[model samples]
Target chain A: MSYKAITLKKRPETVISEDLFDVVELNQPDLLDGQVLVKLSHLSLDPAMRGWMSPDENSYIPPVKLGDVMRASGVGDIVESKNEQFPVGTRVMGLMGLTEYAVSDGSNLNIVPKEIPQEAILSVVALPGVTAYHGLFEVLKPQKGQTIAITAAAGSVGSLVGQMAKNLGLTVIGVAGTNEKCQWLTEELGFDHALNYKADDFQNQLTNASSNGIDLFFENTGGTAQAPIFNAMNAHGRIAVCGLIAEYNKTEASAGPSWVGIIKKRLNIQGFTMPDHFHKFPEYGKALGQMLMKGELKYRAHTLEGINSATSGINLLFSGENKGKLIVKL
Target chain B: MSYKAITLKKRPETVISEDLFDVVELNQPDLLDGQVLVKLSHLSLDPAMRGWMSPDENSYIPPVKLGDVMRASGVGDIVESKNEQFPVGTRVMGLMGLTEYAVSDGSNLNIVPKEIPQEAILSVVALPGVTAYHGLFEVLKPQKGQTIAITAAAGSVGSLVGQMAKNLGLTVIGVAGTNEKCQWLTEELGFDHALNYKADDFQNQLTNASSNGIDLFFENTGGTAQAPIFNAMNAHGRIAVCGLIAEYNKTEASAGPSWVGIIKKRLNIQGFTMPDHFHKFPEYGKALGQMLMKGELKYRAHTLEGINSATSGINLLFSGENKGKLIVKL
Candidate 1:
């Protein structure tokens, strides 16, 4: 049998283009002993994928080598399995590549229940959701009545962070690229305020919205947009650095302020990747799933049909073209 | 009776000069109800004093207003007291300005035992010691066998941080401005390694000294010196942002490298001030005091005599002229 896969053609210096990947046909090999053949149905597109594409950057995960399958989190079904634990027809999620089929020994795979929707499994119950959970609870540790300002407020992680913070009684202020995204954050996600970072009055809006000052900053995007928010942080503020999508595509390094605020405000800035906290994902996923089932947690996914579209679909994240969780359906 | 005091004549934009202060003699006033008359014997000179002199910078304490006594931590003898808790001739320490006499309402004062040397009270038992304590114990949380790097490692806070970290069984690497300071750190303070940041091969030295990568960075001096250290941090590294003495004297803000390391290494950068953690002082002081008396912990105080020399003494801190805990003996 033949399966479709996308391989990294060349590492880009700055902004990623569709040309960086090549869509190719590969022969599907028979499952070896204790191995399961997973027919992937969905692939997760994330901002961190940009970091993984860099040849020189050191990250939590190893960089994708040239001519190798692009690294991604994906959900699929075990079509054929020699492993008793993961029998045929069992649904699983893991660090499967951007491919139509995968061969797994079940090392990193997690069993996903049939009841959970594929979109949620690819989003709120997967990488983005678990990232939001760990970064918020473990890193930021928001308190009741504290104000939290989240950047990339409409993205997969930021959107869930705003909702969860609101649910936990934190006043949520969001910063996003567009007015539409900002509107969705405040109007739909129950955020106290949302400022379009692209707007001329962004600084004023941010200042006014966070009059009480931000107690916690969920930093998803790092660039010039962070300066005003950093200036508005109260004493002893916590900043959970989940991703820096704003600087991901830039050739030159972004300029930050004097950082005197870090001392004056006594802020705690912690950067984290979800994989490091995978041990807690099961508990996080169970809680997040329960919330979703009871309608207490809400999430959105922007899916691009077909695995072939992943090249263009992934760029949507860098260009801010897609709202919510960007995913590819194979 | 009259005593000399240094008042902020004007705020300096960068490097502090003697001209910013005016030495004036003021008549000692009668104590009001609940007030204690403190005759300051030793005044603490700190890098954070430069920040307090900045008119526009945000700080834990309000800036020392123009014409007001310059904000400083001092050890003194309460010659007169209306408060029953603090008897006459009782030694005390607090934000008793750079002066020969101060009348306080006893709001921020801490009673110091006569057995504790005035130099220890001004250096190890006071702000600098407390800052090193909280920053290491609470923020960095260093573990045995971890490699700890400290900037300005011969100065007040950094010196103590090195000794404490060494006592705790961590490999301590010290970064200082001069060879003499570096020698003192490794030879006297028991740091595993010491590098002169001003040396031509500083970067190579830092790389070789910290080949295992720094686990905890007790950041005292900030600016360009941080770039190499930031790059050499291990995964899950912690940085305690105690002070930016390097930038304190710079007219233009120093350019820092892309903070990609903060994310790439999952570094936790926490900035703090001692005043904010005053509640932890008693416990910290008791432990530190015990260590000092038993000779388990070593510290040095470079005292400049006479209250009038405070103008020059403070400048020594920016010039890196003072080797250890810079203090003014009034």
Candidate 2:
């Protein structure tokens, strides 16, 4: 049997175009010892994948090599298993590539309940949910009644962070590019306040929205959002910086406000890669799954059908075109 | 009985001139129920005093008011005592005024060895030594073979930090203003390397000196020194910012290097005031006193003979004229 996979043909200029990924077919690998074959169901598109596409080294993970199978996290069903840990008919999510079928050593694989809705399993309780859970509760550690400011509030991690902060009894403030996204955050997501970042009086609006200082900041988009968010930060504020999707493909450094604010305010700014926090993932996943079952959390997804349209789903993340988790159905 | 005391007549503009301090004669107060009358001996002339002179909102202690006795730390003999905790003839050090005599509640006072040289007791194993100890092992936490970089290397805290790091089996690099200070750090203090910040190739020297990257940075002077120090920082490096003496006297905000290096490199920058760590002083002071008594540590002092000379002693600090601890003897 053969499968289609996107190969990194070349680095894209600004917006990732179709030329960046190519569909390739190859023979399915035989399951070796301690390995299993997974029939991919859904491919997770993340802002971090943009970092992999780049040649520069930023954090823990290395840049994705040219002509290698484009890296992704996907939910799949075990077609066959030579490993006793993961038997046939089991469902798993791990470092499965952007392909129709792939083989894993069961190294980072986990099998969850098949009774759960596939979208809920893949969306609200997947990477986005886990990222928001650990990044907010574990890293940021917001106190009740403290203000939490989040960037890209309509997007996967940001939306979840705002909701989680609210659930933890925090006053949530969100910044989004459009008026509709702002409405969706405050009205639908139960955020205390939301500001349109593209407004002429954006900074003023942010100041008005958060009269109380921001105690915890979940930074997703870095460039323009960082300045106002930092200004509103209280003394000894904690910032859990996850992604800088705003400056991903840009040639030059994103210029805005002075970072002396960090020193003057004495902020704790930390950058984290989620896999580094894998030790806590099980706990986070279990907790997040319970929250979903209790209807205390919400997640949205922008799904693109087939491996052929995966590039478009990834590109939509950069443009803020996708409302939530950008996924490709295999 | 009357005593002469230096009062904060006005805020200083340059070098903390004579007019900045007004000497006035006042009748000595009777010791209260819990109070002790102290005869001032050696007054510590710290760079932090400059902070106390101005009405800055960001100070740990309130600014010395106009017509009020200037705040200081000194070793004094308890000539009269009503407090059971501190008996008469005790040699004590605590927060006092720059005066011939002071009355205290014995709340902050700590007795010192009468046999120890007055200069040695006032210079080392006091606030400066404790600052170095707690800032290094407690905050920065340098490990063996790792590189530790310090600014103001010839000063009290910086010198002790380098010596302690050396004793802990770490490679220590010192940054000082002059060749003499650098020589003292490398040749006498046993620092592995010393770079003169005034030299044209200072940044290159610092970078070359810490090729393995700086695991810890003891930041006493924050402005110009931060650029080179940060350039040499390792990933996840820790910086203990004890003071920002470089920018302390400036009337306007000084332009300095961006701290975005902190976010990119995942560095931990913490600004600490000595009082916040005063709880560890007893433990730190005992250990540091042992180090000094064993001849494991060395220090120097630039002493002013009279209370009238406090202004000149303070001026010497900004001029970088003092080789070590700047003190005024009463």
Candidate 3:
């Protein structure tokens, strides 16, 4: 049997392009002992995928090698299984790659609940949701009456962070690229205030929005946008370095904010990856699921049809074109 | 009684100069009902003084006002006491200023023990020692067999950090500006390896010295030297931001290490001020004193005589000229 797969052909120097990958059909091997063959239904496109494409040894995970099936997280159904634990037709989510079929020995695989919607599973209960959970509660440790400022406010993780901050009785200020995204943040996501970073009065807007000074800065885009936020940070503020999507595509080093701010403010800046804290995923999923069931948590998934659109769908993340979680539906 | 005092005449733009201060002779005031007259003996000069001179509202403590006696910590003897708690001839230390005489309400003062030498009381058992202890044990939390890298390794805080890290069974790598300071770090301070950041092969030396990767970075000097160290940091490394002595004299913002390194390495960087952690000073002083009594912890005090040398003594910290704790003996 043959199935389609997207393979990394060449690493890009800057922003990802469609030419970097090649979609080809490959034969599926027969399932061996304790192995299961999964037919992928959805592929999650994340900003971190850019880091994995870089040939440099700077990422937490190893770089995707040339001519290999591109690494990705996806939800799928087991079409054939030799493992008793993962029986045939068992739906699961894992690092299953951007391919039509994946063979796993049950390592790094999770059984998806039938209750959660298929699209919501990847956006609200998968990597982005869990990442937002760990970063906000575990790392930032929000306190009541504190102010939280988040970048990429319209994106999956940032949107979730703003909602979570609000639920905990903290003020939420969000920064996004477009005016529409800003409106969505404040109106749809219930953010206290949202600023368009591309606006001419962005600096003034940020200062006014964070009048009490930001207590917790959930940094998603780390570039020029963070400079003003750093200056407005209160003493002993905490910065959760979730993602640097702004600088992810840049080939050369850009001037960062004066670190003097960190010292003078006595700030605590910590960076984290979700996989490292996977042990808490079950607890996080349950909590997130409860919120979703209560209609307290909201998420959006920008789904691209077919595996062929995987390359272009990922570009939406860097371009800020994706309204929410970018995903490729197979 | 007439006594000399160093007053902040003007704030400097960058590097401290003698013109910024005025050595004025003023008549000492009569002690009030609750006040004590102190004959200041030893004035503690620290890198933090540079921050205090900045007219900006960035420091934890407000900037020193022009014409006010320059803020400093010092050891003194009570010459006259209207307050019975601080009787005559009682040796004490506090923010006694850069003056030959001062009047205190006995609120902030601490009675010094006769067991420790006068200079050691200020250098080892006081601010610098307590700062190092809190930064190392409380902030960085070094583990056995880990590699600890410290900048400004020959300075008071850095030197103490290296010694403590060694005692904790961690490999120590020190970074300094001059070859002599680097030599002293390895030879006398027992740092496993010392790298001269000024050497032509500095980057190579840093990479080789931290071959296992730096687990803990005690940052004293923050500038170009830290860029390479950031690249050499291990996953989940902790950076205790102590001082930015290297950037103390720079008027313009210089490029910092790509913050991308922090996210990729998942590093935890926290800046701290000693005054904020004064509650732990007694615990720290006891541990440091025990180490000193065992001859396991050694410290040096480079004392400048008279209040007139206050301006130049402070410049020593920025120029990296002082070999140890920069202090002024009045």
Candidate 4:
């Protein structure tokens, strides 16, 4: 039988256009002694994909190579298994790439419960949830009553971060690109304030929202809102730089705020990606599962239909048109 | 008796000129129950003095207000004391201001050994050495066989940082402003390599010197050297922003490198000032004293005569003219 997959055709110069990828047909591989065959059901479309498409030597993980299946995190069900741990008909999730079927050696994929919807699992129990849990509790180390400003607050990781910060007794100020997203953050997720970064009086809105200056900052988007939030930080502030969605496609990334503020405020800024902390995923995933199951966390998934929609649907993330955590259904 | 001191007449706009200060004379204070009078013999002119002159609300420590004695670190001998721990003829070091005499209630000043020269005490046992120790060991948390790059390599703090990193078995690359300073770093201070930031091919020299990418960066002067060093960092690099001597005097402090590198390399950047860690002084001072006594550390002092010279001598630090740790002998 044949399966379809997307291959990285070329490295991105600026924008991640269609020319960067090629759809190809391939025969399903026979499973080896410890391997299992997974038919992908849902795939995650993330901002981190932009970094993976580029060929930066200093990137946290190696870029997806030309002529190779494009890398992605996905949920699937086992159809053929040569291993006892993951038997046939088990639902699993892992970095199974942009493909309909994958042959895994039982190393990558993990068994997940079947009762949960794929969207809920992808949005709250997979990469987004784990990233948010680690970046917040480990990196930011929030204390009760501290004010936290999070950029890209309407997106997958940012939404979870805001929810987690709120749970820790912190005042959460969420920054999004549009009014609708801002409204959703405050109304749906219980964020203290959600200001649109595009608004003219965004800085004023942020100041009014945060009566006490921001003590912790979780940076996901690096654009117009970066400097203002950086300037508003209090003494001994901590910043966690998780992603730069706005900067990924730019020819030249914008300069960060002056180091003078860093010294004066005695700030500590740390940059991280989820891959580095893979060991803690199980630990984080379990805690996040509890948060979701107990009604402490809320998530919305903007899932596109069919595998082919992934190519064009990804740009929705960059344009800030996607209303929720983006995913693709096969 | 009346003693001379320099008072900040006005806040600095750009340069630290003589017009901003006034040579004032004040009479000795009548002793209170626990108050003591110190006849300041030596003063240290450090780059951090420039930050104290600015009225930045977010500054690590409060700025020196107009009509106040200009803040500085100094070593002096106790002439009169009501406290037994710091009695008459005892030597002490603290932020005694740019003066010939100061009154203290034994709260600020700490007693030091009288045998060591006041210049040595100020250069190594006081601000410079402690600043270097805390920044290197506490903030950077360096390991053996790692590569460390330090800016302002010839300055008081940078010199001590390099020597200490050397003691830890790390390869050290020191960036300075002058060739003479560079030579002193390599030949006298035992730094593995020293590159002059003013050199046209400084980046190339740094690349050659740090064959492996920089694992730890001790940033002192944030100018031409900052971005290059930032870009040259290895995976999981650590940065300690101790000072920005080059940026402090500018009308507008320059912007730092884009945070993209921070994310790409999973870098950690921490900005620190000594006042925040005042309690650690005794602990750091003890370790530094052992290094000095055992001849593990070497220092040179550029001492200016009389209190009046302090006004003019401070500019030497900004101009990169002072060859060694700049000090005032009164």
Query: Per-prediction DockQ, in order?
Result: 0.64, 0.28, 0.70, 0.90
Top candidate (TM-score) = 4
* Candidate 4 docking quality: incorrect, acceptable, medium or high: high
Among incorrect, acceptable, medium and high, the docking class of model 3 is: medium
Best by DockQ: 4
lDDT for each residue of candidate 2 in A1-330, tens digit (9 for 90 to 100): 998988888876766887888789979977789999999898888887876776744345677788988988888999898998888999988777788888889986878778766667777777788888888887788889899989888888888899888988999999888888889888889999998888999888888888877888888787777877876787678887777777766765565343344444556666666776777878888998888888888877788899988876788888888877888887
Residue lDDT tens for model 4, B69-88 = 99999999999988888889
Interface RMSD of 2: 4.0
Candidate 2 error regions (>4 Å): A12-18, A252-266, B12-19, B56-58, B251-264
Note the residue pairs that clash in candidate 1: none
Residues B214-309, candidate 2: write the lDDT tens digits: 889888776667777876677788877777677666665454443344445666666566775677878887888888899888998878898888
TM-score of chain B of each: 0.97, 0.95, 0.97, 0.99
* Candidate 4 segments exceeding 4 Å error: none
The digit string of per-residue lDDT tens for model 3 on B248-291 reads 78877666666787788899999998878877877888888889
CA deviation > 4 Å runs, candidate 1: B32-35, B55-57
Off by over 4 Å in 3: none
Q: How close is candidate 3 to the true structure, as a TM-score?
A: 0.96
